[model samples]
Target: MDPDRVPRVRDMRVRVLRATTSSRARGPLLCIGTVALIIAVILGAWVRPAPGTTDTPAAKSHALSVAWPSQGQASALVEGLGDSGDLGNKGPQEPVPIASITKVMTAYVILRDHPLRAGQRGPGITIDRTAADESFSGVESSVPVREGQRLSERQVLELMLIPSGNNIARMLARWDAGSQEAFVRKMNRAARDLGMRHTVYTGASGLEETTVSTSSDQLKLARRVMRDATFRSIVAKPSTTVPGVPGTIRNTNTLLGTAGVIGLKTGSSTPAGGALMWAATAPDGNGNDRLILGVVLHQHADTNPRQGSQAALSNSRALIEAVREWLSTITSGTG
Candidate 1:
């Protein structure tokens, strides 16, 4: 039946009641009947339901079921270029120690303070004895360099991000903001500006175990960093040759090039477990490319760096492939 016609039917009933009423009571009854009809018309207009419909699902039950790693927290964004929002997340959203993934922020802050462009090496930073000496420490990741040797800002960033160099991170922090302590304040401020309320930065290098963030928070950083061409080019390299470093330095993120993963950073320690902030590109089955940004944190917690890092790499690669496969199925109408 037409919903619009229901209001008219009720109006007709009220009029018929008024005609049958006694004259003395007619006036008062007619007022009430008129008010009732107006209310019915208002309600019918307000609750305008579709002409003809039944309760049913709008689309197939193609809900994606991801096999998230049993350990750690993970979040991802898969969408076309310039699109916002993420593909939702798996595991907890609470902040956790993010290991060297902290360096991504270090690089970000440096680039913000001293911007670098493609093919342009920025200012040169002299290696201080402190940074040089820390390179020999067996406890954290570092690359040896002689005191007083100078490297450009671009080269220093390459060292810090590609090799996950803790000392390089400190050096850049000190160079950019006078000291590591001062630089950490900038990091925390940057986090706040980025809307990462759950994140905290206690050190320039994430070695302190106090430097913490969530996978979702790091994903926010991931999107911002990829916008920088310099950061994008540096992190995407699987290996690079740097002056003063023996042989060649390689990226800590072993997942590079796997499942279309292009570039990002990885972090691991006994306290922070293993963490990765990664970016990739894949076809969205709609003739457009989708940029996929993801973060996995606290994989294999309390384990050594090697074990933790391996776990992060393995899990992230699997997650990337799974997302791509799911997108394809949905596009084919078989999800």
Candidate 2:
């Protein structure tokens, strides 16, 4: 074309051609945008998460199991008001000698006849010549009381349960039922009432071989006694002061400060061996109670009392750890 003269009329068609090309390019772009919108809608509708989804895991097979030692004539039991319960026992549930666990019964009877209210010091128990005689170490593990020193009933029960005071056991028996012989009769009757069929309480203290019980029977006694607020309160203390005494009487339970052990009793003798009626409790994350009530009876009976006590404590702690481990695995499992 001839420079400026021929192209004047053709310039408008060039503008139209440019406009057509732009419209043609927009068609593919609109199609691409529509496809992307459809894909996004499909993904939004189909790729959603399932209901109740979370990072937390779930539990499967709530049933729990444990393993324990086969030595000693002992039994370890853990039970609560929940689905979890466990036990580890060696030897038959046959009648075996129960040493100072007998004090649990003595406290039971005294509390049964004369209940100690929560935080109440209770009525005074005078330390007569007979009670004062408990200080004389005829048998091992005796706590002395002055002839005129007066203590509350709760304090006497504390002496009976904490330091394993044999004389206090006798004195409390006499005070409750008028005689140690009579109180023992009540003890047997109460055992029957509480369904401790395997137990017999011949003496106010577990010093006599005639006073015998099975581990299961002691567990039953523990369950019943743990329900009492007064007994529970007295046993939980690590140590307490007598009203007129200068020194504080400490609990003989070596496991008191650990394993969540609150209270119970310890028994040891040449006849009854080393026995411990123990109660353990711990709170879960939600603050629910988990109780492990058990009896380690006649542990290492042939061994000396010191060695037997160590064995009893070791066995009890092992059982507690086993329970905690089993619970951990169950709760942390993925369903």
RMSD of each: 11.1, 23.1
User: Which pairs clash in the backbone of model 1?
Assistant: none
lDDT against the true structure, each candidate: 0.81, 0.73
Off by over 4 Å in 1: 1-62, 81-85, 329-335
Local accuracy of candidate 1 as per-residue lDDT tens digits, 208-241: 8788888878888888889999999999999998
Deviation in Å, model 1, residue 204 alpha carbon: 1.0
Q: Using Cα atoms with residue i matched to residue i, what is each candidate's TM-score against the true structure?
A: 0.78, 0.75
Q: For residues 62-164, could you state the per-residue lDDT of candidate 2 as single tens digits?
A: 3434334355455555465342353534456778788889989888888888987788879998887887876878756777889988888888888888888
Model 2 Cα shift for residue 317 (angstroms): 1.1
RMSD of 2: 23.1
